[model samples]
Target: MIASPSTALVTWVLLTTPAVEQPALGTCSMGIQHLEVPPVPREKLALVCISPGQTTVINFDADLAMDSMTLDGAERFTKVEFGASTVKLIPSEKLRPGDHLRLTVRFKDTAAPSSVTLLLGVHVAQAVPFVSVLRETRTVESYQQELKTKNEELQKCIEENTRLQVESTGPGGLAELFMLGLLSDDGISSKLLHKNFVEAPTNALSATGLVSYRAANRAALMLMLANKAGMAPWTAESATLTREGKNGMGLRVLTVWQPRPIENSAEDSILVVEVKAPDDLQGSYTLKLWEAGGARTVTLHGVTFPAP
Candidate 1:
C-alpha cells in the first residue's frame, strides 16, 4: 500500500535531518560560502551543505590536478564535472539527508596544505550553490617563499636606484644632460606657455609660466604652481604622463623636482617633471602631479612638447 502524504513528508524529513549529536569539527552552512584551507592538516573534516538534485559548484584559488581527485560514494552523485580550478556536482536523489560524502583534491603546485578534503552533507531544506575555497593561511614554507620573492623585488629596486643616483651625480649642464640621454642632435627643443594649460577639476593649485621641452625620447616640463588651498605645504611626490584617448599609452615618469614647498607664505614654487618614452616622444599628453600627502593634485591636459 502507498504511504500517506503526511507520512511521506515525515519520513523524508527524518531521513534528511541529521541525528542530534555533537557538532563536527568543520562547520557547514547554506547558500554561498567562503572557506580557507588550513595551513596544517588535521583529522577534522570541512563540511559543505548539499541538497539532492541541486548542483554545488566549488572553486579553488589554485589549479587542481585531474587525477588527484578522490570522491567517496562517487557513484551516488548524479553529475560530477571537474576542471582545472572548479568542481560541480549534483547529489543523487538516493542520497539521504543525513548522508555525508567526502571529496578530496590535490593542487598541482607544491605549496603547503597541498591537498584539501571536504565533507558534503545532504540537508533537508538547504543547499550551497557556490563555495569559494582559498588557501590563504601562511605556513612556514609559504612565509619563506614570500620572503624570497620580496628579496628579489627589493634587489631589483636597489639596482635601479643605484644606477639613477650614479647618473644624477655627474657635473651639471650639457654633460649631465648627455649622460642621462636627454640631449639629441637637434638639441633640447622647448616651448613656452603663458596661458592656462591646467585642466579642470584641478582647482587646488594654480599653474603658471608652463614650459615643455623634448630631446630624443625624453621630455620635461617646468611650471610654477601656487597652492590655492593653503591648508598644507605642497611638495611634488609623483607625476605621470599619459596619452589621451581610448588606446593612449602611458610614459614612464623619471623624476619630479621642486626647489621648495608651496606654502601660504611662499605662494608660488617651481615644479619640474621628467619622463622617458620608449620611442620618439611627441604629441600631447595628460600630465598629473600629486602632493606629498596626496591632499592636493594638479592635472594639465594637452601638454605638448616642442618637436625634436
Candidate 2:
C-alpha cells in the first residue's frame, strides 16, 4: 500500500533518524533547465545542483568518450553512471552543502570545444533533476527572438532620423532668416562706427573697424581689433550690451563668433557679437567684451542698431 500524506506524518513521528545537514548558501534551480553551450571554450563554468538522495541527469547533444569522464568527488556519490550521451548522478548523504565538485567529459567525435565542464554544487533547498546541454545548436525560437530584437533597433533608428530631418528644415539663426521672410529687398541695415565712439581704455586691444547691423528681431556688431598687448591666442569669453544709466539690467546677448584666437605680437583679429532685438531696440548702448583670462577687455559706447 502506498503511504499518503497523513500516513507519512505518522511514519515521521515514529522514526528518529538524524537529519542530513544542508548547505548554508546556494541559488539552486527549482526545475529542469536547458542550456545552450557554445562551441568555443569559455572562462565561465556552468552550474548544476545536487542534493542528497536526489538523482540529477545531464544530457548532452553529442556522445562522450567513456574513458575521458572525470569527476572530482566520484567516490562521494551514491551512484554515477555514464552512458553514450548522458550522465546520471545520485549524491550520497556525505555530500554536504557548500561543496562544489567539478565534472568534465570529452566528446567521442572531434569538435572545436573538445570537452564540456560543469560545476556540481550541493544545494540546501532544491536540486536540479535534469539539464539539457545543446552544443552549437539553436532552436527555431532562438532565431525568432533574434529577429525581434533587430526589428526593435531598426525602428528606433528610423524615429531618430525623422526627428533630425524636421529640425534641419526649421528656422534656427540668422542663416535661416529667409525662411521667416525677414530678408526682403531692403536687406540687412548696416552702419559704420569710429574710434571716438569707444569709451574703455584701449591698452590691451584697440578696435580698428566697427560695423553694426540690425534685422527683424536681431542685432549684431563686428569689430576688427589689433592686439597691442601681444596676448597669445586670445578668445572672447563674454559680451554684454546695456543702455546708459541701466545700472543692473542689460540686453539679451545671443552669440559671439571669432574665426580664430588672436595670436601674440600685433595680430589683427575680427570678432562679431549678436544680440536679440525687438522693435524698441533704438538709441545708444554700451557693448563690452572680455578675454578668456579677463586680463584684456574692450568696451564701446554709442553703439546703435539700424532698422531693418
What RMSD does each model have against the real structure? 25.3, 33.2
Model 1 stretches astray by more than 4 angstroms: 1-159, 265-267
The candidate that achieves the highest TM-score relative to the unseen native structure: 1
| Residue pairs of candidate 2 with colliding backbone atoms | none
Predicted structure 1, TM vs. truth: 0.48
| Per-model CA lDDT versus the true structure | 0.67, 0.67
Q: Estimate, for each residue in 65-143, the C-alpha lDDT of model 2 and write its tens digit.
A: 8788999989999999999999999998677656899999899988757898998988532467787777888678656
Q: What's model 2's overall lDDT?
A: 0.67
Clashing pairs in 1: 16-97
**Model 1 Cα lDDT, one tens digit per residue, 91-165:** 886676578898999999999788999988876324677887879653465456556756775785685576467
